[model samples]
Target: MAGTGGSNPSSAAAAPKILLAKPALVTAAKYNRGPGGGGGPDDSNRSRLPSVAFLNLLSDSWDFHTDRFLPFLTDNTDFTVVGVIGPPGVGKSTIMNEIYGFDATSSGMLPPFAIESAETKSLAKHCTVGIEPRITSERIILLDTQPVFSPSVLADMIRSDGSSTISVFGNESLPAELAHELMSIQLGVLLTSICHIVLVVSEGVHDNNMWRLMATVDLLKHNLPDPSSLSLSHPQSSDKEIKDKIQEAGEEYMASPVFVHTKLHERDSAPGYHVQVKKALNQYFSSTSFNKPSVDGGSDPTPLDLYFIPCKSNSEYQYESYYSSFWKLRDQVLSMSGPSFSRTVSERDWLKNSGKIWELVKGSSTISDYCRTLQNSGLFKR
Candidate 1:
């Protein structure tokens, strides 16, 4: 549901929005604040997480995550597992490996996946996953339904006597005539454990690609019920009155999603493009559900929930920046190969976009001063 706080943009005619909030939160580096990704004993990663400071911080792995809630998932929640599903070669494995540490790699170091195990089996030796039905505090399961988008994989899974449940991944990619069956089966890869949606746009967006993404969003919106009409399903829902208001305004708290033309690889104006895409989505929501103004005079619209799940090729993920950050982090931690090339993401943009942290640095006279002040001004006190 959308927020009713002034923090949210006024949107009766428009859909209120919220930030995903992960990008802003900062924490001390786990490996002695070193460039390495060592498994450290530092509490900073979890307990000392800094408050919201950046826009894309929501994409950070540990940020906004709740390990305490892990115990609540046992036989007590509607969401039991995160079913990672996506088209073949779409970096489903890569994304999951990065976020969840599944030991998936382009390197054939890990054995080819096993398809005939009746029970959950280990995809790697590091973790004994999917071996039994038993659920421990480590009960958060990451199920991998076969790639249903491909006809051959579907046939293989169906023919197998092992796991029989079929998860339709990206069934929207299927024919329009197969919508019903597809919708029922195709699983959105990030089902559980709150996987952030990283919409990797294809390398290039021709006119047709834009139409495809737009059409996909339109289809999903049409099939799902509006939050306004439904009772709050989140068991740990926040303040009671806020819950009521959110449900009341959920219908109106929408996004404006414009078909952005920029390449996902470009960094200079990505924020501008993100805002435009959001606008297009919000407008469509407004047209369908006209949420009434809050009589209580409160506002807290959050648009960050509107995920732009891109249906495109694997071009964006192959870009240098994503590869550098992910792979370099991987090498630093796992002692893998490091590529010989430039790797410099402007800390300025990320710093500036972080509202909480940026405010402190905004008045600085130089980068060194800003860095020092930022480092000293209690960036994580909140």
Candidate 2:
């Protein structure tokens, strides 16, 4: 049976109300089952939800006790998983906590899956090692994943000679670099598969972290369902054909990533910053062989919305107090609703299905095979 942590009735009612009140302000994410049937710190004392580790999903030693977790997700159809993907120490957790209403001062009842502020610091090591889920509202579940591409993952790739060495589940095609960057790849897989809206966090506009987004976007475009007739031949026979297909397919099948530029205070917040960032992104997208954004800001939904926020509460510099800026961001996320995505996955099923994908990722032997698994995972199908 799924465990609700023996939660109370009043708490349950409040979470759903928050989720349903603003139908557009919603999100969801992935988690792997563990032997203990839960992940992260014991939130019993703090009255918060436990965030799970993704590495646990890859461990053969840990038993995936789905019964304890699936009940939370299975009990509702309206749950929307939201996740943040970016480099290490970029305020992904800070952004997540704010979105989920993890305020220390609020007197109102906490949301159903309220997350604890993710452990953070200035150190370079990865803080979030796995996917952590918290029910923010009755229908809104927020997932905070480990940084997709961190220095640690990069080091692992270098040490492995650009070879994918980690496998706990199935033969998969994936680049050595991507395989080593498991957290990002897994987050990419989850966002592409299950999430409703993804807040793509970054340190700043010029930060190299955008490369992570670029790679994930490329993966998404590559995995788009091939038409029956096109399967007989390489539909992408030409650059023009490739671009045309992507546009025609539309972005509805992909997770609508709203880029949130963090650490805004450190950079010159001149009037030209937004314009400069947009221009740079436009140029970057156009240069890509495929999956380019519309240069004219055309009707095509290729490029996503981008916004800026100052510092997060956890920042070492605390460049500026972010309480007001944080709420502003919350309001924006609540208002901007995009195209619906993926199949109607009950919360319980999401947990089970995500675990299956992890297994496949673990079993793969080559980068190409892992990529194939991700594309064929069928999480992106509408």
Candidate 3:
């Protein structure tokens, strides 16, 4: 759970200047120019249109905001929840904006997720606070999370006495540093349990901290049930039966992970280098369910969903331009027929159950035990 890079180079070059749209300002402008204000017919109609802004699905305090996002979802059973996680300034929000199909060229329109501006980058700040959710016209739900292993986030949660400001571990008091580490794992477990496709992003090819973090997540994620497995009525089920059901669900379910390494240099995009990275990824996750073959009984195992996105300034790799790579990534993600729930569930129920799953993640005894081990090792100050 050690911290990785001191600064994220991906944030400096991942997003194009043209895609810089201020979501907060655009949202505020819409409310101010409502029917109450003196406006023409077109202005009123525009105000009534659905605001293309992201909602805080998970707040900074580790609380889930359910009611605010429920209005955006319908009872439609057909939908996809895609979540992204990485260190701060790794362009998590920028990639999500592209997937949301935001038209940055249009005037007065805001991107679904805001990209980190140059001013924000200069100040060494992050754009997304927690998990920001945006549902597209295609009913694709995108969740952009605050960076993991973030020094800024750690600073916010730590107190003068070294204890954590937030009670993420329930009644147990923990060092802010330890709690911050656990927070990242809990975020990964929650996304894997609730989302159909989780984007595991990294700044560059050399950094493998996120990969290690996910391996730890897979280890600690035990007896945690997915959102689809929740049920309101189980009157006849015995205690043993319930435990067995949860065990089966945990062993069978895991979100399809797509490893995205961004901000690559020209040399990193060479055909030989790309093949080596893909092979390494397959070897790293070979034992995990991420490499499981299709349920259709295909003989060959599914290859690891690995992608490399080069920096925008790299014109030498014209075949895989930054913009074109993003477009391809978006298309492949949307078209992927990922693993589905054991049973059909409505969108509202999915949101409601996801909240329950979050609680389980917070109270997980497996993760709590791991924290004790880290504390005993004296790796982080108490």
- How far is each candidate from the true structure, as Cα RMSD in Å? 20.9, 11.4, 9.1
Candidate 2 per-residue C-alpha lDDT over 191-304 given as tens digits, one digit per residue, 9 for 90 to 100: 544465678778866685655565555544343322111311452344455446546656424555667777776454454777778656655554442343456888553554
TM-score of each: 0.31, 0.60, 0.84
- The TM-score, computed over Cα atoms with residue i paired to residue i, of candidate 1 is 0.31
Q: Which stretches of candidate 3 lie over 4 Å from their true place?
A: 1-23, 28-54, 232-242, 247-250, 294-300
Candidate 3 local lDDT, 1-382, one digit each (tens): 0011132333222211111234455544432221222332354434443443545777657878777566445566667889999998778888898887776786777666778889977877777787877665455678888899998888888999999988787777788999889989999999988888999999889999999989988888776666667442343544355457777655556888999999998877787888998899888988876778756789767787988889977767745889888998988898887777656776667788788778777877888899889999998886
Is 1 or 3 the stronger prediction by lDDT?
A: 3
TM-score quality measure for candidate 3: 0.84
